[model samples]
Target chain A: MIRRGGRRGGVVAAGLLTGALLGLGFPAPARADPEADRIGFRSYFQQRFPDVPAEAWIDGMYAIDEGARQQWQEIEDFPPYEFTVEEGQALFQDPFGDGRSYGDCFPDAGRGIRQRYPRFDSETGEVETLEVAINGCRARHGEPALSYDSKEMLALTAWIAYASRGRPMAVEVPDDARALAAYEEGKRFYYTKRGRLDMACVDCHGRYAGAFIRGDHLSASLGHPTHFPVYRLKLGGMVSLHKRFHGCIRDVGAEPFDEQSREFRRLEYFLTYMSNGLEANGPAVRK
Target chain B: MRDVVTSALVLAACLALPVARAADDSRTPAVEGVLAAVESLRAQAVTAGHEWLGTRSLLDEARAAAASGDAARALELAEQARRDCELALEQARREEEAWQGRVLR
Candidate 1:
């Protein structure tokens, strides 16, 4: 199933070399221009699907898959994630044994703030995901931190993402050197080939995006951040971003990184930034 | 005369082929040693928290081959598994630093 032919080895090296050369040639040297990358990324997808509106991409492959789009539309009529969202709302309001609530931990009680997460915390010199921030709040409140890939965490995130629905993704890769380094690290992770399959995220979702792999259509990476904590019918459960990352890595035969690992946090940081300006639509149903 | 030389060459190659095969057959199989090396690397990968699934599958196949008494096949598989695990370990190490080189500008 691993397609090895065409555009594998030298393409990655060429990209790296080109970037390095460009960095050296620039007057004010910077490792990357997120703005330029954003323009290019959006343009590529736009050119690929001239008819599909930018906002429609939040639906992922359904933007391209007509049949799946119909099914997804039907499924969304009575969304499967409603129960989980209700549970998340209940959990959010429920106070810890210490008598404080999840609201106290976040700005605006975490309302409409999903866009700002996976932020570079200058204090910690690491990317802070929503899951990490949630657990941090729990620990501070003398409550147990939930597992990054647990149903509780997913439910909580689904609620938060629901709260932020229609809010644009606004993740920042801060100007700090540490933050920049983390962003670059995430960019590297995205492009690097691994596993016996020797595939990078770019190979499928980047280059051959919209191309079919067996029965599944590869979704472009641009709008990946829009819909998350998705209710996957195949999985018959909610899937967190970290869980999806694990599955994708394992799909290519690579060892899955630990959930909420530094590498994963960085990846989330980069990916969410890529989807900046896209409206958050979560607790989404997916096939 | 040309035919005679051609015939002689063929006869010589035929004689040498079995000798080479016999030499290969005479050497001690390296399967056990290679399998051990692969297992060691697998343990290291586990400690590093980056064990590759392919490494385990290849090692399992090598073990099965060994159990079936196909030393040559076992040796080949074991050597492959060893190389795979070694590469996996190296990948984990190299990415620690090499990731920086690929940052998009």
Candidate 2:
């Protein structure tokens, strides 16, 4: 089940698909429009939940909960947490009607399958996350496409997410013609000012990263996405990569993104490219 | 004499528990101030050896409830969120330091 899939063969499929999409679609849209300046950071903290526990706010009785630092450390098992790896491993082995398993689709060569994701696939000129690739795997095997947010995918993705853990994110906006094009689009998005503050992401995370806003200090976006499926304290639950992007855009005073919007995926690609070389901190603990 | 000691202990606990007085006095200003301060620290994203973001954020919400005149909520949230934030902050700080060290290298 844990078999081989080469890298060279997918280029043909990608090229054909990219060409077809561009053939009929409208031209690329304008960059993000500016939003008004609203000065409040509560959405990051407020709307996520209500009513905290008693130990969280007692006067001078903080030792009641804040005392143990090691108590909450997540234990990393060899296989990682979640249940879908078993299914994915199974699918990897089962052969399709053409006697082609998912592994057979790839050219016979090599792959750093888990380490490279949110990758810049030059053949199609598209930025692909692991979730996209998994569906690609499904389509290659002639299986029905899985939803991007499905639990099966989330679990399999989580395992793959686990696979990428220690690897430095190698994604790059190539200096060559194709990569340069995508990079330009992304750069325009990053610096071109958007939403309420008329503030671009560069303004705060870039210029004012360490500055204090109200009470909490702002973190620099550098090395930000080292973890995935991070345990968010705000929602009292776990949140995924794009969800964070959605929150950040909303916080900027623009309308939140539809979770699966191409705009978001492009933004995610650009952002991920920006933080390249940083290891994934997915399945992390965020305040 | 026994009655006097019991009364003294009860008085100390009363001062300690806002809800002990009115069962609704959960917004301890002192605690809220620190919680807010911790949140500020979290945004700095230089979490120390602790993981307190959740605790701090949760505490703020609870404090709001208490301040809105719900002593019961204030007391409950104060205790729980405080514990979570404190520990979380410490963990975050430690990890942040380690992460920065790696980055700086």
lDDT of 1 by residue, B1-105 (tens): 999999999999998897576445434356566777778988887665456767777788877767665567777877787777777778778767664453333
Error of 2 at B29 (Å): 59
- Model 1 steric clash pairs: A31-B105, A32-B105
In model 2, the runs with Cα more than 4 Å from the true position are A1-114, A212-215, B1-105
Worst 10 residues of 1 chain A by lDDT: A1-10
Q: Which candidate has the top score in TM-score?
A: 1
Stretches of candidate 1 exceeding 4 Å from the true structure: A1-30, B1-36, B39-51, B57-77, B86-105
Candidate 2 structure quality by residue, lDDT tens digits, B1-105? 999999999998878776444533344565456556645644433222122224445666766775676665665676675555544445444433332222110
For each candidate, give its TM-score against the true structure. 0.76, 0.47
